[model samples]
Target: MSSRSNISQYQGLLERIVLCFLSTGPACFFLLINGILMFSLRSKPVFRYTCRYILLYNLLVADTAQLIVTQVLFLLAVGRVKITYAVCGTITTMANLTAGISPLTLVIMTLERYVAVCYPLRHASIVNIKNTVVAIIAAWAVSTLNNVTRNLFLIEYPYEKFGKVLMKDYCTNIGWIPDSLCDDYDRAYNAVVFVSASITVISSYTGVVIAAKAASTDKASALKARKTLLLHLVQLFLSLAYTLYYPLLSALAKTVQRIVFVWVQNVIYVLFIVLPRCLTSLIYGLRDQTVRPVLLHYLFCRWKLSVEPATC
Candidate 1:
């Protein structure tokens, strides 16, 4: 029994160490990459005005907020720290607000791509910088309102037998709210958003593909259109994976051992949330033809300066 107990304790410690790295490492890297992208876009007027870069910038901001919240929760869990009801509630609300905004933003991005690809002649008027900025603000406002309303029902001060606020692994809706309500809300929210967004993305991408195929007279333009829509589909799929992550994590928690549950949860969080957010910088920002050249040029200049001998 003693040996088994020691083994279990060590295993838990190992899990915590791994979870800390998984949570913080990607977040820091994402912040760095996003900073570079933001600076590059802001410094270049051409990229700043482009609808695609504007949408991507908003997405990066949303993802960074989500990552910061997630990392804080991970730190609390690893340290076994209990927080006040208000603090926990505030963190949970912020996390939900950011989480809600991410998918909505992605949906808007897909719609923007649809307009740009399917209605090339009107794309400028329809998806300009001004319209993109307004859409981003609307997405943030709607998501914030929805999450704030839902969080109002959260039970922030749930207590144990000794009349102390119960500590939890993370500040989450499921941890703070009644199980039934949490289940119902999650199901309703996921069903409505996931189904609606999936339909919009699929339909829009289909239109884009069809439009690209029909415009075979400009073969290069048609090919570029198809490729751009394909990237959008990839991004949509990643966002869908993130949407489904919570329900899957809940299911696993009920069935798995304590150690197994923590391990799986951390892995799921990193893979579905962190990894996809990092990939967005690569797929949507850096690899973009217009942005790539600017990024490369900036990096090359910085590199050249570091290597050149100092002037006498």
Candidate 2:
């Protein structure tokens, strides 16, 4: 029994070290790629001005914010350190705010693509720079309202009798809600938003598919429509995974042994939460035609000669 216990402790320590590496590696890479993308966007006026690029930029910003907060939380978790209620609450709030923005921005991107693909003639007038800015602002505002309101119900600051000292080994939403009622409330709120967003995304992508089919005579337009729709679908799938994976893992954590739960949660956090955010910039933003050339030019050809702007 003593030998087994010693081995178990060593295994746990190894797992944590691996988890820390997984968490930080992707985070640094995400920051690097997103930073370069942002710089490329700013330096090239033509790519920066388009509605799609603008929305992509906003998505990148939200993902980066969420990634940073998540890394902080991950480090704290790995250290097994207790944090003050106030500090934990602030971190939770920022994380929730940024996480909320991602789905909202994704929905906006879906709608923008729907318009561009489904109504090619009116895409120019419908999704101009001014309206795109408004849409991005509205996405942030709506996400903020949703997160703030939901968090209010989920957490009670004065958790103890003295109303001052609240400390926990882990800083997470699970700590904030003291009972099942708050849990139910959080679930209900998320359900409504998730369902609504799902409906909108499905409807928009369905329209895009139909439009693409109708434009089969124009090979170039149809191909572009299909490619864009496929990318949107992948993003939507990742968003769904990011949103749902945590709740499921949290529920499972309650039923498992402490050692098992820790390992499971760490794996799920890195795989579902961190990996998707890092991939968003690569899969969605960098692969984009307008942005890709700028990235390539900066990394490869910037010193040699001037690169002509690509048509939107």
Candidate 3:
């Protein structure tokens, strides 16, 4: 290889390292705030019946998972391992689990919102503590099952070519097990999961917008509902787009794609997963009166100042 090529590769590696630093730090901060919010609300009885609390809890959990896995694994890659296929595979699976489950939770949350706003009378009976726990358990269960089933489809294979040559470092000789046996099965399963989750989220939120418009007797209530749905729609778009891109890039290219894919993956981790958790409390705090008061109470306490009368 030429010196120029070596320089370029080194530069790219440096860029990835910088990107990891920029991404992971902010991601961790967001995850920390999310943890605080989740724990704080756990003891609040008023928020127990609301969909916001449930959705917030799920969002925090998924983003926290993403931050921990990505941050630690990337650090490990930098400090210890040389980024082997096995290491990369494990990271990819964990990242996918965090990324994939996020959107699914969004779908469920939007559906929960739809039911609450559309059918206010039945919201209480349907969205109780018992049902919310069940729903959360089911989401985690389904996500785990999906990851296990998909990872099984990928098999590592060794390659040799031109008789008497072991091609360990070359690109062409090193290969996956079989396209027919593994690629199609994995792609089909993942596509189904991604498409189904995206459609479900979008459709449920669309229904939410409609129901909000129809049910709101006042303009202010309708506007508030619209704003919340809009924010969720943006999140849904970001998640779905990345979920589609990651698999597409992996399937199409073999080498040189890592530069683009790795960076893009980091971007999604920041934008879709991390940014939401950091900004969610702020978003709700700035927009909603109820959230603002709760946040203020937590942050700024108005303790009574006792003083003796001044005797001059």
Model 1, 1-312: lDDT tens digits are: 999999999987887887888778877987787777776666665666677767777887877777788778768866577775567767877877777776788888888767766777787888877888898999889887777667656545344431345545555556655557666776787678778877887888678777766744355665665676677667766765666676787899789897788778788888887777677778766667677766665655553211111110
For every model shown, the clashing-pair count is 0, 0, 0
Runs off by more than 4 Å, candidate 2: 1-15, 154-164, 213-218, 254-257, 297-307, 310-312
lDDT comparing candidate 3 with the true structure = 0.59
Q: Rank the candidates by TM-score, best first.
A: 2, 1, 3
Cα lDDT of model 2 by residue, 1-312, tens digit? 999999998987887888788778877877888777777767766767778878888888888888899889888888777777777878877887887777778777878877777777888899898998998899888878866676666445455632356565588767754567666766776677677777877787677667656734355665675676566666766765666665767798789987787778777887778877877768755666666776766666474434456433
How many Å off is the CA of 133 in candidate 2?
Answer: 1.1
Each model's lDDT: 0.71, 0.74, 0.59
lDDT of 3 at 197: 64
Per-candidate Cα RMSD to the true structure, in Å, reads 5.9, 3.5, 8.6
Best by lDDT: 2
Model 1 ranges with Cα > 4 A deviation = 1-15, 155-169, 215-217, 297-312
Question: Largest TM-score belongs to which candidate?
Answer: 2
Candidate number that wins on TM-score, 1 or 2: 2
**What TM-score should be assigned to candidate 1?**
0.82
